[model samples]
Target chain A: MAEIVSLADAVAELVRDGDVVALEGFTHLIPVAAGHEIIRQRRRDLTLVRMTPDIVYDQLIGAGCARKLIFSWGGNPGVGSLHRFRDAVQNGWPEPLEIEEHSHAGMANRYVAGASGLPFAVLRGYTGTDLASVTSTIKQITCPFTGERLAAVPAINADVSIIHAQRADRAGNVQLWGLVGVQKEAVLAAKRSLVTVEEVVDELEPVDGGIVLPSWAVTRVAEVPGGAHPSYAQGYSERDNGYYAEWDPISRDRAEFEKWLERTRTTGVPA
Target chain B: MSTATTELTYTSDEMMSIAAARALSAGQRCFVGIGLPSTAANVARRSHAPDLVLIYESGALGAKPDRLPASIGDGILAETADAVVSVPEVFNYWLQPGRIDVGFLGAAQLDKFGNINTTVIGDDYANPVVRLPGAGGAPEIAASCHEVYVIVRQSKRSFVDRVDFVTSFGHGRGNGDRARLGLPGAGPTLVITDLGVYRPDEHTSELTLTALHPGVTVEQVREATGWQLRVADELARTPAPTSDELAVLRALKEAS
Candidate 1:
């Protein structure tokens, strides 16, 4: 049944230092807000994994909370002429497990490979390039007959995932109106999942036909009406853009981050 | 009309307006959003100023992406890109520090005083009508990028008198205190529309029409904007595209 626990308690209990936490959300939908609450409570050497490096990853990394990261893009495209996460490495931030953008598809396949306990996943798509590096990280093996190179990424078993959403039932059935696939992927890839909902309904509207994961995937549902702060949800509220666009310059300087820490932490709306 | 430049045989879209290209160049380092700015800046990179360090916010530095990335998440930007980064580092470290020379963005609307709101079309924020992709990193991109380059097709509705919501960042501070607030790169620099390029004056930072495309007229640009428009004194003609420039751009687009 749905319960009202302090987000602080819910997330703090699950996230550990150095854990590879996969934060769900696209450009700005269905972010791990409660988990971010855990972020504010204490700073630890954490590893955050997401598709492309954006504000959330940048904020955690810049704040010194994240020691390593896994993501794609990390800078404004043109205005600044930089890919931020890349700059972090050249500028002395810890080097992360860099993956290609298509690595998601490969990682997803690895999950199936792991669940099935298959020895390796095959590489058929792009043939060869730096992307072949995945073969190194994953156990690369060759087909004795075909003699083709294969990429075998290890199945990721996350400790737990803190997910926020628009609605969930007492039984823990969840419904996310937009951008639902990867959220399911992250949840399925993790051992446990902590959910935060905007509303707790008796049940939910019929699945949007195309929806994938069902209630069985959810572990616990925590109701936080405005959990997706700083970040934006699909139809609920728009992203606080004014805040995000201004991050580049501030994150670049350590001193500025100290000042930002004062500002955000002082007014830190207890996630 | 028929005699002079028709030999070029370029569509209005093919050759970028000079003002539009230059507006994109103002940024020493650009966190390219995608689409037009990506095209124009890459074109700018090949032709005039080779120094423009092109950063695909997707973490590709000077990545001559093969084609228009389907989205920021496309593999082209990631593969051809110089480096990969965590999503957070893009915002926390690179942009906020004022290192971003300019933010190249595409917007839904730009009100007078150069305020851009990419969130919604209707009035209500709670639950009234259409919901756009909530600001992913646009706001931070807008707020923090030292300057911004806006590439929007010309339209009266798009150049609105006011925005429903300020979904991304731009120089227009909430209470008109961007400069006063000590915000670095707190405002927009050039606006590149389908018809022409525009910039703000030295003091007011108001959007002023600067130069028109080859065939475009001042009235055509005026008709597209909702606000009262101003023109720059030295409206220059856009540069002609060389065969080499076209070939490189074509190659970049094809690799994706």
Candidate 2:
């Protein structure tokens, strides 16, 4: 069974320095609050993993909590470039961060392989691209059946996985819907899992196409409404598109980013 | 010198978007990349290709949005989608099986043979001059979709002779490259830019300027390109955006 705990306690217990942590959400239901808590706790040297490293990852990188990022895409969605991510890669301000990049298909397959308890996953990908050259995780394998060549990538089993969801019953069985991207696999693929939810209900009513993670599968659950602020929860809240647009300028300059970081530390929530 | 005057009501970007939108046929399943390609695909659905199935990597399949989605995973996409699956399924079942018909994409850098680079601007991957958002779904989308279309603004900086990195494979060197690599899908066949439309040569696989938007000169296109751009022997003039197209595009933009 899962433990119902406060956000701080969950982060303190589950995450540690130099642990491989994955905060996976494609666009909807991103665990921004947990990411903020990690920043507030000043965790260091962690390898942060996600498919698309949006604003939360940007904040984590800017806060100097991550030593490496394993991700596919790193942009601000409809908005332009992630200035802080650019700064780190180009200048190495707070630290010289390392990156292991892949296409979305490759990253998704890795998670699937991890969830399935497989050593690696095979796909018809990265044949003519330079990604295979740069990423050592990608290698060529021959099919025993047809003698076909294919790309194989290692499974990504994280030390801990964190995500945000719509709701969970008091028993800690989590349910989420609407563009449920890679969260289920991510949680299952980790040694431990933390889920932050909008509310804790008595029962999880059957939702169409909703994914349910049984209590035994999860490690911890915390009630944090609006946890995915700049992103969103489908029925709980709307995505604050304005904030995403506003973030571009705030994250551009080092001094401005530092001021924002200071504000986040004082307010107990990211500004 | 001869003087010619044409109505300058719509912007070049508007022309580019309309041209790109017209390329999509009704009932084609398009795997859309965000940004300019998203705008064009939406415009196509709202205007001509109403049955055009819009698939987002965020797992919204056949998404029919009233407004432009701010991001691929915008609630509007899921709320209006025919079905929603997980990201893994979107790539594995729907895309890798060659179910999608078209892959519409945008690029940070493009080469003459249509290879895309959204990974890094500089040659050094570890320390890049500009670290673009690395490949999202473009690599497989470029590989698995039956056909691929690219839309980007044309400039000397973006339209380079050789992209710094090959984030998505189009044609490796020239003819028979994709075949030699055993890639299933036909790589980038059409490229739509802010200036004009380019089609890959049937034999050489080099992008050749097939048509130019109204009021744009061949000289202007050449000045903006990095390579020795090839112009079609009989370059056709792209029709200016009709009043209807302008109205629909403007309304869509305003609504978003």
Candidate 3:
């Protein structure tokens, strides 16, 4: 059974130091509130996983919460560079961050493998490319039937997987629509999972393209409206484009990033 | 209407966009990336390719976003999409299995053979002067889509002899390299640039200038290319965007 808790409590209870945590959302439902809570609680040494690490991951990396980033793409989307991410890699400002890069296909397959309880997943990728040499996780395997060479990557089983969705019923049945991404796979792959949603309703009315995770699959549920602000919830909000544009300058300098983080610390959310 | 040769109100960017958009036909399944590529695909969708099956990296299938989405994950895409599935399903079922007809993208750097680089700016990977948003689904989309169309602003710097990194395999080293590597799709078929349109030479796999955009000279194209620019024996002047194309593109921007 899943326990209904506050965002702070969920973060405090599930996330720990040196744990592999995945906050899975493609571009929508990014779980910004949960990331802020992790920063507020001062968790450290987390190996953060996501396909595209946007502003929330930037905030986590800026706050010195992440020791490593396992991702395919990291950017500010339409904006330029992630200065803090560059700082950690170049100067080791707060701490030296390690990167385990993979293609989006490889990362998605890793989650799929994890969800399926398989050791690894096979795909036709990284052929005549350089990713295989750089990423240690990527290996080569042959098909038994056709003797075709394929790329294989180990499963990504995390300690805790967190996601922000549109809504959930009181019984902890989470429902998310729009751009679903790998939230379901990440939840099924993780040993423990937390879902923060915009609302807790009495009934889980079906959405057109919704995926409902049964209460048994989730560990905790927290009601955090506007949880995916800066990103977005399908029915609840629009992507805060202004914030993304505003974040470029804030995340450019170490001092600016710190100032922003301090401000967030004071308010308990990014303005 | 004052017949002053249809005043050139649109910039070269819009010209390139319209040129790229025209390449896509109705009902083609397009695997689109963000930025200029998305803009081109949407322009096509609004203008002629109304039934274009727009598949985004975020797993929005048949997305008919009325407005331009800020990102691939923008809720507008999902809201307008016919269906949304998990990320794994997107790559596994739609993209990897080669179901898509066209792969649309933009590149930070491109080589003569049509190989693209979107990873880094400098030679050194460890300490790059500029680190770009690494490959999301480009590697697979390039590999599996039936054909690819690249839209980029042409310059000596962007059109290089060799890309700093190979983010997506094109013709590899040209000739039979792609086939030898077992890449399913025909690598980049067309590269639409601010200067002109380039198509791969069937024999050499090198991008050759087949058509020049309005008011753009072959000399300008040659000057912008890093390598020896190849021009077709009888180059075709790419017709300027029809008023209808411009009208639709302008309306799209205004509506979005």
- The DockQ leader among the candidates is 2
Q: Write the per-residue lDDT of candidate 3 for residues A150-182, one digit (tens) a residue.
A: 999999999999999889898899999888899
Worst 10 residues of 3 chain A by lDDT: A126-135
Candidate 3, pairs of clashing residues = none
On TM-score, the stronger of 1 and 2 is 2
Flag clash pairs in model 2.
none
Winner of 1 and 3 under lDDT: 3
Candidate 1 lDDT over B75-163, as tens digits, reads 45545655555343354456656677878877778866566765446775434254333344455566667777788777998887666
Write model 2 residue lDDT over B1-256, tens digit each, in one string: 4244556498999999999999999999999998889999999999999999999999999999988888989999999999999999999999999999999999989999999999999889888888999999999999999999999999999999999999999998888999999999999999999899999999999999999999999999999999999999999899889878888888889999
Worst 10 residues of 2 chain A by lDDT: A262-271
lDDT of each candidate versus the true structure: 0.58, 0.94, 0.89
Interface RMSD of each: 18.1, 0.6, 1.1
| CAPRI-style docking class of model 2 based on DockQ | high
- Evaluate residue B117 in candidate 1 and report its C-alpha lDDT on the 0 to 100 scale: 61
Worst 10 residues of 2 chain B by lDDT: B1-10
What is the CAPRI rating of model 1's predicted complex?
A: incorrect
Docking class of 3: medium
TM-score of each predicted structure versus truth: 0.51, 0.98, 0.97
lDDT digits (tens) for residues A168-255 of candidate 2 = 9999999999999999999999999999999999999999989999999999999999998989999999999999999999889889
| Residue B26, model 1: Cα distance from true site in angstroms | 35
In model 2, which regions exceed 4 Å deviation?
B1-8
